[model samples]
Target: MGAFTQMIMGYVYPGKPLANATFEAYAMMCVDCGLTAISSFKLGLYMKIPPKAMFLSQVIGSFIASACEFATVWLLFSSVENICRPELLPRGSQWTCPYNQVIYNNMMTWGAVGPKRVFYPNGVYSNLFIFFLLGALLPIPVWFLARTLPEKKWIRLINVSTIFIAGASMPPVSAVNYLSWFAVAFFLKFVVYRKYKRWWAKYSYLLSVAIDTGVSLMAFLVTVTLQIHNVNGIDWWGLDVSDHCPLATCPTARGVHAEGCPAF
Candidate 1:
C-alpha cells in the first residue's frame, strides 16, 4: 500500500514532490476509493445479487471503471490540446482542420489552458486529473448508503445538492467545454438506470449525491490548500488572468500586464 501510494502521488503532485504531502493526498484518494467500492458492494447486495457475486462484480466493475476513467482523462486532455493548439498539432491530424479552430479555441479557453492556469498554476494536469478522479469515484459510497435506506427524501436531496456543488466548484467558466463530461455522465447514468432500473433504484439517487459531495469537497479543499501554501493569501480560485491581459499589439510583453501590448 505504501509503494502504491507513492506511485499515485508521483503522478499527482509531480514537480519537486513533497513525500509527506503527496502521501497524504494519495492516501486520502485511496481511502475515498475504498469507501466507494464498499458502498457499491453494499448497494449491489441490496439489489438482490448473491453476496459472492456482488463482491466479485463490485471489484471487477470498480477496477474496470477506474481504468476507464484514467483513460478518459488522458484522451480528453489530448483531444482538447489538439483542438486548441492546431498550429502545434501534426500536419496530418484530423483535428487540424481550419473549421475546427473555433471549436478548439473554445475548448482550450474552457478546459485546458484557461481554467487550468486559473485553478492550478503550479500544475494543471495533476489538479484536473484529481478532480476527474474524485468525480468518478464518489458514487460508490452514495450508492451504498442509498440502498441501505431507500425511503429518505433528504438522501436524494443531498445527492442533488452535491452534484450542484461539484459543478459549482469546478473552475467557474463558460460551460461549452466542461459540459461534455457532465453530459456524458448524465447520459450514461440514464442508460444504466433505465436498462437496470431495479438495480439502479437501490442506489442511484444516493450514489449521485455521494459523488457530487465528495468531488466538490475534494476539489475545494485541495485548491484552497495549494493557494495558502504557495500563492500568498489571495484567493487563487477567483483570480482571472484574462481580465488582466493587455489588448494592444506589442506582442513582446510578458507577465500579468494590464496595459501596453498583449504578451505572446
Candidate 2:
C-alpha cells in the first residue's frame, strides 16, 4: 500500500528525485511501523501482556532502532567506498549494495526520469500496463475454483497476491534466495509440522526470531570489524558475484546501446 502510494506520488510529481526519495522513505517507514506495531500488539494480546507496557516498549524500541539504523547507514556510506555505485565497486567486493542500487534505479526510472517517458503509449515498456488488468482479474478464476471445488485444499495455495508480492523483491533477490527460502519453509512448515507438531508449535517462532537476530548481529559485526577496516573476508567464486548473466540487464529496445551489450 505504501509502495503503491509512493508510486502514485512518483507519477504525479515526476522529475523530482529528492521529493520521490523522501516520500518513498517516509511512506515505507510509516507502513512498516504500522504493520510492525499491529503484529506486536497482536502478539502481546496472545501473551496477555499489558497494553500500556507494550506501548511504552514500542516507543522506546522505535527510538533505539531508528538511531541504530541511522548510525549503521551512516557508517556504511561513510566507510564503504562506492557504496551504492555498482559500476565503480571492485569485482568480488561484498559491498555491492544491491538493495541501494535497486532503490536508485527506481528513483531514476519512476522519480527523476518519470514513468511517462518509460510507460507512454509508444514507449518501450508500454505493454506493462496490461499488468494492472491482469492483477485485478487473475484472482477471479482462483476464487471460482475454490468455491466450485471445495474438496481440493491445494487450490487455495494458488495465490496471485503472494506471487506478485514475492515478485516485487526479485530485482535484489535472486533465484537462489527464493529457492533456499522455499526449501527451508517447506522443510520447517510442512515436514516439521507433520513430523513433530508439538515441537514445531513451541519452537518455530523462536527459531525464526533467533535467525533474524543472528543475521542482523553478524552483519553489523562484519561491517564494523571487517568492512570498515577494509579486511576482505572469504575470497571465493561464489562470493564474487550474484548475477552471472550480465547481459540480462541490457536494454531490449532496438538501437539502444548499453555498455558491453551487443548493439541491436
Candidate 3:
C-alpha cells in the first residue's frame, strides 16, 4: 500500500518530503482499515452474525483503535530520545526505529530522488522494469495451460495472483518467517486435518485468532510494562544476535573492502 501509493504520489509531489509522508500514512491506513473491514465482515458472515451489527461494531472499533494508535505514536515521539535516528541512538538501544528508517528511505528514494531517476528506462536499474513484463505475461501461460489441459487438476494450483502477492512482505520480511508459517500451515492443514478432521474443522479459525491475539497482547504488555520503564531484557549470545548473514552487504568486486566484513 505504502509502496504503490508512494510511487504515484512521489511523482505528483516530487521533492516534497512532507507530502510524501502524509500521503504514505493515509494510503497505508486506507489499505489496512479497508482490509480489516473486509476480513471482519467475512468472519461475521461465517459466524452467522448480523451485517448491521458487524458494521456498527467495526465502525466503533476503528475509531477507538485509530485514537489509541495516534496517542501511542504521539507518546513515543514525544518521550523517546532520538526516536527514529539509528545513527544517533546508543548501541543495542531498543528505540532504534527500524520501521521508521524504511519509511524515511522511501521518502528520500521516491519523493526526493524521484522514480524518474531510480526507474528510468535506460538507467542503472533498467532491469527492474522486467518485473512489469513478468507480472503481465506470467498469468497468460497459466491461463493457457488451465484452458488447454482442463482435466489436469495440478494446473489449477498455479495461482499467479497469489505468487505476485506473496512478495508483498519481502522487503523487510525474512525467509525464516515464511518458512515458519509454511511449516505450521502444513502440519495443521495437512496432518491435523487428515488425522482429526472434526477437531480441525471446529477450532482452526478460532485457534488462528487466539494465537494472533495472544502474541499482540503479549507484545503490548511487554512494551508498556517493561520497555517503557527502561527495564531491559536479559541479553545472551542468542538474544544479542543479528538475524542476517555477515556477508549480505559486502561488495562482490575483486578488490573491494567493506568495514567489519571479511576481505574476499
| Best model number under TM-score | 2
Q: Candidate 2 has what TM-score?
A: 0.89
Separately for all candidates shown, the number of backbone clashes (residues 3 or more apart, or on different chains) is 1, 0, 0
Model 1 misplacement above 4 A = 1-21, 62-164, 167-169, 172-264
RMSD of each: 16.7, 2.3, 3.4
Candidate 3 lowest-lDDT run of ten: 235-244
Task: Write one digit per residue (lDDT tens) for candidate 1, span 1-264.
Answer: 332344344445443234434454567578878888778777776677788887787778878989999996576466444443545643333233443443334334333333334334544343554755676667777777778889865565456436745555233243543676678577657787679888787777787779789988976575455432333234454233222434532433245454555545
**Candidate 1 or 2, higher lDDT?**
2
Q: What lDDT does each candidate get?
A: 0.54, 0.83, 0.79
Output the number of the lDDT-best candidate.
2
lDDT of 3 at 146: 91
TM-score of each: 0.31, 0.89, 0.82
Residue-wise C-alpha lDDT for candidate 3, range 118-226, written one tens digit per residue: 7764245657768878988999999899999999978989899887888787645557778988898999999999999999999998899898999999888987887
lDDT value, candidate 1, whole model: 0.54
After superposition, candidate 2 runs with Cα above 4 Å error: 87-91
